[model samples]
Target: MPVLAQDAPIRVGGTLPLTGPLAGVGAIHKLAAEVFVERVNARGGILGRKLEYVLLDDQSQPANARTLYERLVTADNVDLLMGPYGTSSIIAAMGVAQRYNKLLVQSSLGDPSLAPYDMQFPALPIGAEPQITDTEVLLDAYAGMATPPKTIAFVTSKFPSALTIAKGGQEVAAARGLETVLSLEYEFGTKDLGAIANRIKAADPDILWSGAVGMEAVQLLDAMARIEYKPKRHFYLFPAPGPTAAHPHAEGLTTLTWFEEHEPFLANAGAADFVAAYNERAKAVGFPYPHAEYQAAAEYAAWQILAAAAEGAGKLDDAAMAEWLRANTVQTALGPRTFEGKFNAGKASTKLKQVQNKQWVTVWPADLRPSGSQFVAP
Candidate 1:
């Protein structure tokens, strides 16, 4: 712990997808970060110094995120760095962090295998092998049902992380003795899913794993409804939580989640307060689905990890902070996280959440679910 000559506000810089396709979910991260920073400052800040976050709009562009990170490090000279949302933007930010040897704590990075930087830590808890681990977790939940899916279909976007996870899932499904009825890959930004929806309807597998992001899942479901076809079971990779829950076709829709607005998750220290604060802030901004979920939990956890590392090391040194995180577990809003595994990832704490009764709730892993909440097989 080195003493500073003078007390100054610690500036942390990062980018968010403020205006683009991913803007809907991106807004949740921004609001969560804002609430975390405000609470940190209210509690005498990190290391007894005020914390200032310099967030820039990446406009959902990976190229812009790369450039903005370079500016944050070189020109702006921010004391520390936070990672941007999404896999592509996070990868771009990781490149800049590696170049400058800055410690980056990110939340929504989809693929951990692509991250080779030792200074970067993830708060998502998808584990080192998310492609394998996440897939297994999802399948494990499905297998516990009274009627497990025997055949599966995969409709994935060409996006890097989603594609990687979907491919891994296909392999896992094969090993688990499930038949693959249909496997299709589409362009990332394809708007009209009528053709794809018709193809899926024809195949009609027992379960459909949609490697979709943002509103893609909703659009696909809408297309399916037009043809009066629906799968027995469906899961989304990273759909917009609010819109998906509100959708008329979203009942029994399952997705990956680390936290939800429920008993066990809210029981974690500071979780309830954070959720309440985030809800108030979100409502003030006229944001829909103001409840804190996995995305918001992950973002707040990133701040928790960074702050814990800084306080644990008693300094703002990037190397020290990284080492602290690597050595110990930080209890985040989601749960405890450690950066000790492959690619500096924590344990795979990914849980399966489903849209039941027009709300997202943890329905799998029986113990985590609220009383009377069980998997609703369609």
Candidate 2:
């Protein structure tokens, strides 16, 4: 390998939904990425060169993401690319990365199957088949209850990833002998959830599975509250952590998580420090939920993977970085992640978390739960 000049900073460019529907959670990713870069540069940077992150707002639009990422690669001439926040945007960025044969380390892509690009690597630990693996994890937690749910009602978003996961959950429920009383699908950005809430209240199943993202979960819960209908139990697929936790109806609201600001998870190398840094940054910006959770952890982990690949390869070469990531496990805030599976995905280390006492905490998989935390019956 030829020696590269250290006078210039290595730029990593990407997009985030900083000012749109997904902005709430996208802010978490943005803050986390900022902290990661700050810490990395403070520690002498990557391969002795300073690290620079070039971020653009996609406004939660896939088409905007496609255009912005093209600008990052062609116009700005970024040396590396970081993947965007949502599934649709990530897919758009992936196309640009594939075209340029660059390594894309992404955090929040909902659907993994859509990523056919070999250079793309996922930082979220949802595994290659989250539709099956994630559903199984949730159902497994439910099964540990004294009286397991016998019937379920699924309210899904027509968003590509949510639809796929919701349909897969129905199959997994049937296989587990859980009857589906009612299943509903609505447009991705539906605001008025009254009619859907009314129908769900009418069905009144043992558990309600909502494939909601961003503020959709809060909207559904509020609509249900208006109708005086609260299911015995409920699970949200990809909710915005802060908003969902702050909602009054979100207590005991279950969701999937790979990291939480608690023991075991915080025991990972640099996890506690990252949490402290994120809390300070989030609080400084007047963020509602100032605690570090799965979203922040995943975003930090994505940066960790990129840095690890670059350092391990001893350069900022895209192919060399991807090769290094495939050959070794990167220690991340979510723990050690190995990109050995399909599309450079790691194992499905999904854990169940819930809002307890207005805080998101891991409660399932007894062993990984906080000292006194246990799965609360909803």
Candidate 3:
């Protein structure tokens, strides 16, 4: 029997929500991957083999994700897997990848529970310490204030992302001797934030924390405007301020960010160039890309993984590639990364940012601050 040729240019497949409730967030990351593949192919492909990305729309459905991933691995014979953008979708895909012993590179999924899994690859750099614990940092800052915000509100939707952030935030508040005057959970995509906004205004929280989506972020801002109630401060996650067109309301709102906009790591080198290119592309498309720093950081890291594994394996096959990726240290724009098992145990997550002027200015968590937080209520 003739030996099957190795090093074949094969397919890499996974799930992505190109449309649905979380469509905006999903589309941004999907577009980023598309752009990354385009750049890779333009540069003569990886290891002299043209890379083909096989994307399927999970449509924000977990069941759909399982179905698509099964197709990728069983039917289409994908060389490897890149996980989906959300927590639920990634978890579903991870199950399949492990079952098939296929390598799965994941971006945008931060379940923390998924960290224990073996088949998963942390496509983005891991934090030195858990970045999710940063809510305490903010709470501590409040406690030390001459006068702490007498009333604090914690609001989030029932989505997994919101729940995770709220869980961490609540823990911080509890540890810091701060009281959560109101902790409420709304259904995802609830447009009528008026009641919620009114309740919050009546309570008069010193700090208004929003653990919701970009649309909800906009809804909160709109409702606040209508009710003429603005908290002295607002903290947010997920619906990052200033990064989207909805940024009008998010202006000056503070929240945690996955990337630092002007960090030396991101300010100079190939990663910086990538960010500039993404910005240019966003402008050309008439819809500026959301999460430029985060998306750029992820794509740059993915390319690093691909390059390191390709160089190490000296050929392309899912098993060989997975082995190389697990064992090798990939030099990324962030820095040198060595994945400890399936997770990158070496990297640290950066702190949060506040939207000032018209840009995301890094603040909090001490290490990656570009400038002192200048978040004053407008």
Candidate 4:
């Protein structure tokens, strides 16, 4: 009953945590979606149908997402949908889409348990397979180190997505001959990470992997700094796209990412232009994150992929659009990608990135794009 509408528009609906624990990233996700919708509609809507994205606030609660998704599909009868910001919310959204047999594209989900519904496309390059790391390209970074870290520790959040990644990392790291010195999962919104940091420092692993989101990461990072618990190397998710990278404690920190600049695959594509557009608007609005942080490129790529599918289908038929996507790869801001399972296939798949001199730079896969800095070995 509580929603926004546009007359005769091709309604694209979703749920995001506009307020709550995930509010920071949720706002960026919503902006990226709206930017894509706005751009597509400005250029004569998808398949000549104006896009009206009606996003409901899930309040960062999976249960709220369940109810909100039902409203989008059953009551509002939106034409298409996009998944919400995190794993649980996305799973909730997927359920609603599957029930209605509606076409849905998702971003920001990486739990292996939910990967079984491969029916819903994922917007990231991660898999839920047992013993499979979130992004092996990153672990390869560790293995390739001249004096590679021999021991690794995982400090993670209790969230399902982080848990899956940590589990996979533990398996993969052990297989890679790295000792698992310590593995700890902290409750979300943990106020003080003193004990966690102390434990990791005591373990004194050469490598530390953080499974915390942006806020949780800050807690752990701050505590690490307080205790001077800098591991030989540190990699984390979240806070990858925000000002946290500039934090003094984040110097030489590393994380895996989906996008950067001068990707040969997208050298002459419209990807740069799309990024520029989002960057300009975001900067104007005083948004601190770049395109990478907000996932603007990937989300816009999803829109581009969906639009191409709609044009290929030549009507508002969800099945036709889905079939087209399965059979062909489309050029998106992310690069040429096909829904070959959970993630879209692309050349610049993932990057091992590090913070050097307060800037995030790529350090591996050597060819994706030069980080213009050497890997600061720990």
Candidate 5:
């Protein structure tokens, strides 16, 4: 049996959307997190101090994030703060971290604007640089199509993250000499995609781009199929339909996402083990894991840094641990990363993913592509 540390406990607090519209993704995060904490505790804790994590469900609400953060920092008096599952929640909790001077180790917040937080470091191996670079790469690749996709459309929900993605797409489209025939933003929980579908058809865009959540995306894709409106290509943003949901509507679709399993890692590292563990853990929860490599990679990397910091401090002092983390260089599935320090401190890598025969396949960055683009029959 493992002995418990009696000196002092290192308490880490986190917020996740365990129950909400985005629960599918949130659930995956929770499972991975649970295992991470369990594994750390099993190893006799960190630095002779037990690592305790207090996880709360933010219900995917930005407002709830604010309340939960205050409760954790003020009432619970956690040693440190960790970033949340979604961008909004993390953004909401960030102010509290700043005010409290707690270090925020990031996991899923990808918005480049959030990079400015000096005390915060994303667990994600990549950042906004990829989103911007990849969007341009995607547009350029589309332009090279035998029959250039002259007209493009971009759609997203009112969420700030989705809006940021859509905005990036618009910029890329403009640079590539592609006309954005349609750009629309809808409020959350919108039940109607009929009008949106009609507009896309009217514009006759060769490519259709969307930054929608999983459920909303399912509805929109179904509507497109119902109308039998198949553009030359379809590009989707993060957390969109995966193979299971995407295949039916996205049979001939081309989308960009944050993860590509087949991509050749510059350093093989522990990717195989990570994927296997992640898949097994995900299967236990009855849902195939979310495909974003960044999420899992970040989670793994965050824990690595935390362990390093804990060992360096040899105790659980918040200020001491935070300082240790900033000074340590951590290994990630992507590669070795050193904290360049945050000032919108952006540094990262990205690979493109496309749907091929109802399967998500890596297709860009040359060296990492599985086979190549599977241009659908238009």
Candidate 6:
């Protein structure tokens, strides 16, 4: 029950999984928001007031996120609201934001379809919709190969985010005339990846896709290797960063994401400034400063959106900000984007990348594609 001071600051609030499974992600999001606050305040603050972000630790639990969000709006009285990381946490917080009608801006919650949630939960989610460009790029990349994969297998986790990704992939695959050889669902943290991998090998699919998170992606890869079953292309929705999946057997490992480093040309110096300031503060407190971390960049972009909308609206009211979202486009670090009623109303920001030669190389989204970064087969 932390208390907010009766100070003149544009107080924003959200939940983060700061102490549980997703603590690393939560820490990055918090770092981004804090860095944004520091940078903005240094530039005379927002509307003559410092921006204050009140992030609560939801412990990577949706139930805790919902309650904390309720407390954020009802008890803490946050002036503006933001969504938490991951789909389930965001979904849980969305209802709370809607109940209060706060201008809810989202960053990392990457389900392209907010329509179903609108119908099911009946909340007006007002913010930039995540551009889910990775799935299509994935299917198309596979389709372009000399001998395109005709059969696909979906190895998915039961997490809402994973399910959403799996569903989106299935729809895209079906449209592309690819047959579903096997669609397997496993619970996250289930110690049965070997069994799932065995099933996948038995199915003998051409392309293998997994909608699991972090270490699960590695586990699946390990299982596939142990069984000596390799697909033409293995698309993992979430991957642990670095060269962990770049070994010979892991050659074809892939993931569609906007979470990678933004091209140098597209990089925003303002974002860099935030990083500089963030690093300074982190160094002072002995906290690690994640430089150029994609998740942090995305959350920082959300703060930029809020600042632009608040300035454009010339008020702190949610509806006023909503109006601003309707009319104005903001040049975020990611790119030029406008809110298409809580969605990316423009081109998607996602790209397909693969682990090649122990490095993550961008292979799709024609504008960002690099030389020799071909969508080479697995």
lDDT of each: 0.90, 0.91, 0.68, 0.72, 0.67, 0.69
TM-score (all chains, Cα) for each model: 0.97, 0.97, 0.86, 0.91, 0.86, 0.83
Better of 2 and 4 by TM-score: 2
| Cα error, candidate 4, residue 218 (Å) | 1.6
Off by over 4 Å in 5: 1-9, 125-131, 240-247, 252-259, 263-269, 288-293, 312-328, 341-344, 371-378
Candidate 6 lDDT, 113-192, residue by residue in tens: 65233311111122333223456777777766778788999889887767767877788888878899999898766655
lDDT of 1 by residue, 185-224 (tens): 9988788999999989998998899999988888998999
lDDT of 2 by residue, 1-378 (tens): 655666688899999999888899999999999999999899988888889999999998999999999999999999899999989999999998899999999998878899989889898888888888878988898887889899999999888899999999999999999999999999988999999999999999998999998989999999999999888899999998998999988888899999999888888868999999999999999999999999999999999999999889998899999889889988999999998878677788988998899998887787988887778984
Which 10 consecutive residues of model 3 have the lowest summed lDDT?
240-249
Candidate 2 TM-score versus the reference: 0.97
Quality of model 2 by C-alpha lDDT: 0.91
- Give model 5's clash tally: 2
Query: Model 1 Cα displacement at 261 (Å)?
Result: 1.1
Q: What's the number of clashes in each of the models?
A: 0, 0, 5, 1, 2, 2
Q: What are the clashing pairs of model 4?
A: 112-128
Q: What are the per-residue Cα lDDT tens digits for candidate 3 across 30-129?
A: 6667677777778877767667888899987888999999999899988767787777788888888888877677766554555556645666554423
Model 5 has an lDDT value of 0.67
**Please, what are the lDDT tens digits per residue for candidate 5 over residues 1-378?**
665546567778988888876666666666666666776677777766667778899988989998999999999988777778777888888888888877777676657575566777676645555446656767655555577777788888877767777787688778778788888999865768988888787887877787776467767777776799766677766553343334476665555543444546524445555666666776665664344354555666666666666677786565787666667666656556566634323456555566666566655544566554544434
Model 1: residues with Cα > 4 Å off, grouped in runs: 1-5
Output the better candidate (1/3) by TM-score: 1
